[model samples]
Target chain A: MMSRGEPSIRLESVNHWFGAGETRIQAIFDASLSIERGSLTILRGPSGSGKTTLLTLMGSLRKVQEGSIRLLGQELRGASQRSQEALRRRLGFIFQAHNLHESLTARQNTLMGLQVHGPGGDAARQNAAVIHILEVLGLGARIDYLPEKLSGGQKQRVAIARALVSNPEIVFADEPTAALDKDAGLHVVRMLKALGRTRGTSTVIVTHDTRIIELADRIITVEDGRLLPG
Target chain B: MTLLLHLLLRRTPIGWLQLMHNRMRLVAAVAGIAFANLLVFVQLGVVASMNSVIYLTYTPFRTDIMISAPSPQLFGGALLSRRIIYMALADPGVADATALHLGSMEWKRPGGMSKVLIVYGMAPEAGAFAGDTITDQQLAMLALPNRVLLDSEFKDVGKDGSDMAIKQLSPETPLEFEINGHAVSAVGSFKLGSGFGYDGALFMSDQTFQRLIPERTSGTLSHVLVQLKPGADPALAVRRLNERLKSEHVQVRTAAQMIADDVNYMNTEAPMGIIFGIGVFIGIFVGLVIVYQVLATDVAAHMKEYATFKAMGYPHRFLLGIVFEEALIIAFLGFMPGVLLGSGVYQVMAMATDLPLGMTPGRALTVLAGTFVACALSGSLATLRLRRAEPAELF
Candidate 1:
């Protein structure tokens, strides 16, 4: 285990490719960036810019093939499976699609975030934590409703609650507001900003939403699989 | 235990919830499983019924040992010489012995239709039969020439014999029939049921049997029934008789050995048991396929959701657990209806065929265990596709 350090994430000279032989194509090239504690960063890029790939690599969802990525002060280059799993536990992820289990209710979906830690603590406390997060996200009345019954924005809120309920040090979201209306999108971004200031939880989002771009503390742009000057 | 149960209940029942979410798919999967179970139950039931028939057919003759020609099937071999009965009586373990003559002949019914009847010719004494309906009085009735005892439960001689134009024969409603063109009178009745090969049975004295079938010689016999003395071991007596009659063209066996031999012959030599066994295999295959389809489709439908779970660091083991849970649930749910409906079918078949066919605890447990294992195996295989749901692709 490595000691805690400043900046939730640090990447240096990261190079990644897909496939092999003649079919091989590079996806990330000599990219280096660092995200600080309690900061909201947005990854902005055009289509086929490999922005999502960079996000996944930093989130520990993808292996660092070349260079070094230190997530939470632990180097992820050639890391063992166990260490990777441990790193993933300290981070949360949200996709462009809400990806909520259609069978589970909003409260149940939120509870899954805690469930990943395995059985620990009292059931009552877990239930209280899940309920508090759902209510905080303005889903108190619809907590018992399944995903199919909720609107697009409400489901997105449930997803957000799921990511934040576990008290993760950093969160990575890809286009988290694409399905929401203008007001809902703005409200979600402001909520993340508030959480960053109050809890010191860092966040990195990938989106082209103009409203979200304006609220970002930092913006990184990628074009043709290469990071440009921020 | 309470704490464990509480913890278990606290965990979200994702598998059950997912299965219940698709009502139509669940119904189809369950129906497919039930149909497969039904097929297996009926096939096994039919084979068991055949065994029951053989057991019941031999239940009446209460002899300690049987000396007969070396034939696998009963009443379908070369006739044994009556000297084998005399040789069996010489054994100190044997109390007495009697020769039984068996033959099958076409009997002309009242409506001019002919049906085959199995004839059992024995002496006018109670030495051969045990405490069956063939009592001294019934044997005495058979002593008179051309007089025989009819099987009251006899329907007909063949599969289509039940359609014959003859009322169910009882002692009170005596019927006259001709065997091999020889006129005979059925003055009494017994309770031996019809077997698969013949429609009915007739009991007569050796003299009357010779008169009905003139070609049968008096010295030739089908079986020699050996009655053991009090406290005599049948196995020892049978061993002694086989040794004593080793020089003769005959075999000695206890009643149980005879039944075992017959069952083995029917299962291996005849096609009925083999065909039914194949049916059971086909049933299991069908059930496996149905469960696989349901689980695989479910995993495909929720690929993205599973990917989300992976990204959440839930581990592949947890996802595998959910699939297994669904399989066990389906197994339990489908087995109940399948067994219930199977028992009902057994009752209907028993009533229709008059065979001792019913569910045994052992059979039910075996099938239940088989179903659980098969479903679990299918569930594990179905999760292969789930492993390919890459969280990186979710973007």
Candidate 2:
């Protein structure tokens, strides 16, 4: 963690669990990391290594139990759910399932990310920005199509476009290319790194896909909820 | 919540759009509305039809005033004197007045003593009051030595179902009644009741009533039913007549006043009011519950979407507006089918049962207005859950 005006992503000795008492599964155990702005970090791990859990914790989806996790310099545990969602306006998210609201078109889905956080922006400008993002992300023609209408590669690209449309300060992606073929997977990886670099966003991608290891700036491996040496 | 609405609506008018997506839920919701409305229309129409039919039957009487002695069944107060009747007619503005002699008597039947029957006496052609159906044949029978006009529904009165076919007097002209040994011709047969509505009614001349009533020689009457000239102000005439007849122990009023007095008499110390009161309360309760059930289910199904909006920072008021919009839609669409179907229900009741009934647009509107308020209030019960549910809890 060399250069930091504010660490876009930070976690300190965080722990989390599901259920209570007799039936609890500790998903994140003693995890800590700092993502500097504009750095590209890859969290590489095997199945059930708590990568998704850690990502969600940092994303403010799950409330942390024992320790503090902060995003964009704001403490996650102290903030209300609404405040956390507001912070998500500046935070992009990508999941393995590519969970797009099934009813909305790709263009509209991307616009939702922008609308959620920005209250009272000009409609015309928002439309133009969304169109611009779709075109830049190579989804210009497919923008009007629903998720089921798009190919796997195109869906992931639409997801990428949605993540970046808000111009979030940090992007957290959980295996964005896991469902794509090799060529499309490589394209997704290259896009994540390039988009982050272009916007000066801290991008942390959780991936088990080994084909695009060369595309990451630095890869950190995790096993059994503990961070392994890079 | 406006901001959240702006976000959700900005996504699509997915509220309506979503209905297009799930045709089944849409159909179910609409069906729920239809069923709920059907119940409202049917029950309310039955009640309204009865009240309106009674009103129409009596509203056409040409009487300027009516007098009756106060009683539970008596709406305008019942049984007044012949002296008061003559004095009211003597008032300068009062063009003409007549006494309506009404009382109940038992018509002896072969099997046993029959039920009590109502008897009314007034001029057959004079316009103060009229009777139900009394045909020329029935009138001849009444004029003859041994016959009286029987109820249209009472011919199979004592016979077992196997042998006796019900023969309704279904009379077209006047019939006759026998008191002691004298024959009294009935000019008409009213629908089993007076303006104070009883089971069966018989109309005859005052002379006939003298034979039927023990006090007939005393020259008293049930009360006076009156009529005014073409251009007379009824209210002014009533005041004068009341003053003129005060010495004779009487009161005077227009036909409308008489009806109001009747209604007041029925409502104020009458058991009939209890029946109407129970009916109204049950109507509100049944209507409120069904509407609330539908609205609550709709709210529950769509609550996640609302939560998503809340998560995005929409205010509570906008959400409330959205819920109320749904309620208004239900009130109108649901209520109209109910009214139409309710009319059908009332029609069946009128044709099949003895209830006095007629459905009017005014009554339909009144039910709709009441239903709108009930549904809106019930919808509020559903909306508060949406307004108060924490967005994070939904996820």
Candidate 3:
């Protein structure tokens, strides 16, 4: 069981490689970091700087090759597939290109965030929760529209709604605001910050977008596959 | 259905939604499946009609028992000697026995066009076989030399050449035709339709048949038609006749057994039957390929979304469920149109060729079950690509 005092994510001497033998390339090098609850940390890096790799390692999307990654006080190194899957449900992920299913409507895609936990009680309540979160994301009018019918920013907002509707303990965003305009981007960050303060949810965002930098509680920079001092 | 759809929508129909996302692709997939189903149905229908023709040809000769050489098909192997008929009559349970000669001969139409006719020869003393259109008077007419009875219901529309149009001859029209270089006149006509092997049939006396087919000796017979005493059980009569004929290389069968043996021969040994069976398998292969293509494309297009699902903690089983659901939907949707079109084709073919060809409920159900299994198989094969769906790749 995790205590309230434990940081949401802790990494120690984490190293990751991309390939094997002649083609092998080290993606992340001797990285160590801790992200506390209720804190919004931003990972800023140039292209191929391993910030996204670090984010994936912390989010349990990638296997730990050499060092330890403790997510919500559960060790992810050499974790079983079932255990990794269980740990994934505690976290939310937003990709760079709003990867919403083209066939699903906005509301239905948002519902997928909760539905993955497997058929919980009260579908009506789940639907209400989905709708409420979409409304908060300023997508209430487009709830029944497919991804093709929505604009770029609207699609990204739908992706965000899908990520946050489950109220996950940790949210990992990769350029979540790349497709959004200034106001929409600010609205999304503010929503994440509000969730952090109210529910003690931690957020780790990887982006080159300069607008939301000041709003982050701590900004970690990555250069040449290594993390610099905050 | 509305209730089912409502429940499905409430559960977030990811699989259904993904299939419906691309209407054109869905249509192509369904069309492919429907085409495969149509191929199977038509092939099955043709084979079934061939079987029914076998039964219809033998319907007129239905009797208490039939004695012939041990051959898989009727009139297929060696000819039986009339000695078997006398041996069968020796049974106390047997009433009498008649030697029936059967052969196929080419009829030269007026325009030098040729048509094949199945010829039957029996002793004029033997009255018309049961269920046959031939009456005692018709049998008497066959006693006259160089005289034959034609099948009035023969339809020669699709039998090779249009010049051989002797469509629906009447007894009033005593058509003159030559069979095997022997001049024979149709004194009257019978009501037997064409079967799968022959374009028409003719009935005549044994002497006239011997005259037309000179190679067949006087004692040569195709089958010995047996009649049982009214009070005798058919099984006992057959057993007794078998015992009486045990010395000879011949077998005795009831009318039902005769039909079953002929039908089984047509299904298993005949080249056409084997070809049609292979056609059914080819249709299934075509369906599998089509469904695999559609599903592989769908999986490829949505690889990233699926990886996202995996990252969201959804198990591989959930993804498999979605794909298999799509395959099931395709199977059902395609089956309806295929069946409708197949029934239409059966009707057209039945009219074009006077054969008992149509869809039975059992056949329809079998195809439906086949379609489901095929699509399910395709679903599993397509999901082999899903094993490569790594959540880490989506990053």
Candidate 4:
């Protein structure tokens, strides 16, 4: 059992690769780090520098290939698919593309984040939660609009609302504000930072955005799949 | 079951939303499936009607056993000796026997066009033969020379729009036709549907039959219909009759067996039967292809959303449920229009061919079940590509 004060994510000698045989290419090399509870950590790297790979591995979106990763005090190496799914339910993900289902409205898409939790509460309460989160993300007016009908920034905000509605222990984001304007981008990062402070929710973000980097409490940089000294 | 319901309530809305998102594609998919179903329904209807019509031709007789020439070809091809009837009557189990004379002759219609028709000849007392179809009064009229009963449901117009042989002549209307140079007048009408064998039919007394075709020998008969005594086993009588008439070269069959034989021939031995079966196969094949294409394209368009779901910890079964839900919806929606269209086609076919073609509840249910299975199969096939959607690949 892990206490609430423990680190949300701990990594030791994590390594990852793509392809096989002669075509094999290493994406992450001997990476080790710990992300504290209620803290915002930013991973900074250029294109193809393996920052996204490290985030996915920590998020349980990809299998740990040659190292140990302990997320929420559960070892991910050699974990069953069912266990991984259970672990994933305690976490949230936000992508650069704002990958919302095009046919679903903003409110419906946000509700998806809570679906994996099962039908625990009444329908009204669930709906209210989704509405509250969307309103906080500056998308209360566009809650009924589809992804195609909303502006790029609005879609990103809806995505952010979806990630936070679950109140996950940790949020793994990859360039979440890439499509947003500077103001909207900063607003999203600030909201995430505030959640970390008030709700004790930890966040790990992969991005080249300097503005977002400045807001992070901890900054880790990667170069050519290798982690550098902070 | 409760668990299933919960999962369905959670997952099906996404599937429904995805399908309804593109109205044009959804309409196109439903239309394609409906057309395929229509093809299958129409073909199966014709095949079923073919079987029923053959039984209709014989249902009126009410005989327990039928005797005909060896390997008799459907009406009027072979002639049996009259002695076969006498031999069958010798059996203690047999109660009555009647000989029927059947022939096909060219008749000169009122318009002076010649058309081939089936002519049946029996004793006037044989009026009791077709209890419901022919009345005792109609049988007494057949005793009069040159009087005949015409089939009322025969097709009068041919595919070329020219009158083949008969017109829509009624019983009260003065009707005269020349069969083998002998003049016969229509006195009444009966209902017996047409099939692949013949279009129109005429019933007359044996005296008129002999007069119309003088070449038919007096000692020969077309068939012998036998009725068994109460409590007599038809199978036993057939066996004894077959033994007694071994030298006569006649075949013995029960009424039910004879009907089944005719239907079997039309279904298996006839070209039309095979064509209808092939048509059904092609319809199923086309349905499968159309559904597969629709589902595969839907999966392809939504691959990114699927990966996102997987990343959110949804199992593969949940993703599959979405595809299956879409398939089931398409199946039920498409089948309704298909049945309506098929009923219209059946009406047109019955009008043109004068055959008893229509939809039955049994057939309707069968087609609906087939549509469900076809769509389910398509959904299963489409899920093969869904396996490639991985959260790792998406990012």
Number of the top candidate by TM-score?
4
Interface root-mean-square deviation, candidate 3: 1.4
Q: DockQ winner among the candidates?
A: 1
How far off is residue B229 in model 2, in Å? 19
Docking quality tier of model 3? medium
Interface RMSD of each: 1.2, 4.5, 1.4, 1.7
C-alpha local distance difference test of each model: 0.83, 0.63, 0.85, 0.83
Best-performing candidate as measured by lDDT? 3
Residue A64, candidate 2: alpha-carbon lDDT: 71
- Candidate 4: regions farther than 4 A off: A1-6, A119-121, B1-12, B69-77, B110-114, B155-174, B239-251
What's the true lDDT of residue A37 in model 1?
Answer: 85
The candidates' DockQ values read: 0.63, 0.13, 0.62, 0.57
TM-score of model 1 vs. true structure? 0.87
* lDDT (Cα, tens digit) per residue for candidate 4, span A32-66: 99999989999988888998888889988889999
Model 3 error, position B8 (Å): 4.7
Which regions in candidate 1 have their CA more than 4 angstroms from the true location? A73-87, A119-121, A197-200, B1-10, B90-95, B105-116, B126-133, B155-189, B227-249
> What is the lDDT for B352 in model 3?
81
Candidate 3 reaches a DockQ of 0.62
Candidate 3 clashing pairs, residues 3+ apart or interchain = none
What would the per-residue lDDT of candidate 3 be over residues A41-63, giving only the tens digit for each residue?
99998998998888888988888
